[model samples]
Target: MDKPTISKNPTKKVASADHKNLSSIAQYLKDAQGSHKRSIPPLDQWQPKHCGTIDLKVLANGEWWHEGQLIKRQAMIDLFATVLWKEDDTFYLKTPVEQIEIEVEDEPLFVNQVDQIDIEGKTYLQLKSTTQDLIIVDAEHPIFMRPFKDELRPYVHVRFGINAVIQRAAFLHLVEMGELSENAQGETVLSLKSGDLDLHLGT
Candidate 1:
């Protein structure tokens, strides 16, 4: 079945009065996000029955929305980000108790920053996500670019099949780090090396 069509802007601009109850939602977000830290939930090991879909949707820019209202709390976004998983092209919010599907406008997570590290002369790139998760770009977690509208956008696999969109600034960093090299077939290519793994960005 086809997924529901999301509006151009996933967050609809409701009347200002709609925000009168932000306190309650903020508290709910804080409770969910701040409730647990130190250790991540074992979502990979979770085997729960699939629950019905929810109105939750992750926007292309990494902001979240519920029932057309923006989820403006960073703590809440961080909380939901922890439980996110992707099966094929579908995104899910899973805990030990249950799993429910959610819509994603673009890539689920947004990678806003990138930094390079050197370990015994081996360089590795680390990605910092808006959700405060750090990921290493390596063979297991590689970078890719796809056409978005008229331009190409880069993304990297963070974890559990969740792809993080490399934003403008980080995209520039990745490009600056790229080196012009040759492929196995001696074809000219542009690639980035991280931890002894050379990922071809483009030819």
Candidate 2:
């Protein structure tokens, strides 16, 4: 098998031509957020199945039986895990909320976090960084300590791709409810009666 080419110094080019399109993409994200509601079903309730493991040959060729070129199995699994599905067969790589989860050590911790938020005060937490360490948590380890140490045991971990989608959707939903704004510079500027806080990228 040929080792996949890894580029170390890829060129950095500004996408000046697609600024308007990028703005539209941003708007789409905001719209998805605005349209989202808390009443949506949770991940476990949705019953998303593992759908069985698929090999790289089948994925790249869209056929069940093929002896075509093969990529590393790990790389293929990573690619498949990041993909999003629109219909039963249509697949893309964007994030969606139905697949996301917010995990806490206990119900009390979850409640405390929520209670810390002031009434009518907006709070933001970045799912990406919070779940980054758990991306590869060994299920055989204790859930609470898995984030800090590499242990072997079955543990529960949140799906970050889904979380990112949900957070973005929620933020945009607030804006549509007249709670936030996007400035001309394409920055998501939010407003609250109590005052506004510029949300840090990962927070």
Candidate 3:
């Protein structure tokens, strides 16, 4: 009876285990591919921001104006970027993009004004308020106006880059539209081409 004992077969058990592992691996690969296919490009990725009528106005005047009110200052208007923040301790003469809350004579007043221009035959119907004492900021100033630090922390400089890209797109659009022409002093003059007049409004 001792000589009749037989060893148990382990081959079948090993083969079954290996088959499951291989199937699991294949499934994992399939899942990975599916995830990759469904992923979307990040917002900071290089892309063009299309220009609208407002952008055209900015390109024309180097600033965005509404109803004779300055919606955004020219220097603050980046042909290639957005303002992240205004540098502290510097005399940022340019208008701030953020909505400011001010208390005037114990009454809170928001100083946000819109700049509108009605298009009429390639020219603009301009209507704006008087800006007699407004001080314009120089574009060549040493002070840097960046976006809010907290809002763009982990991705330092990305916001600025994105803004710059958008501005460049707008400029390119203006050039393609034949709205930009070279001047005698090598400066760019943004004006409507002949026979393409439209209404314009600026701050």
Model 2 global lDDT (CA atoms, 0 to 1):
0.27
- The worst-scoring run of ten residues by lDDT in candidate 3 lies at 102-111
Which candidate achieves the best TM-score against the true structure?
1
**Candidate 1, position 163, lDDT:** 82
Q: What is the TM-score of each candidate against the true structure?
A: 0.76, 0.20, 0.18
Residue by residue across 18-99, what tens digits does model 2's lDDT show? 3213233334444654643312222233444323211112221112121233323432223233333333332322324222
Judged by lDDT relative to the true structure, which candidate is superior, 1 or 3? 1
lDDT of 3: 0.24
The order by descending TM-score is: 1, 2, 3
Better of 1 and 2 by lDDT: 1
Backbone N/Cα/C clashes per model: 0, 12, 33
Model number with the top lDDT: 1
lDDT of 2 at 84: 30
Predicted structure 1: lDDT:
0.74
Q: Is candidate 1 or candidate 3 better by TM-score?
A: 1
Q: Name the runs in model 2 displaced over 4 angstroms.
A: 1-24, 32-142, 147-156, 160-203
Error at 118, model 1, angstroms: 2.2
**Which residue ranges in model 1 land beyond 4 Å of their true spot?**
1-39, 180-189
- Residue 44 lDDT in model 1? 92
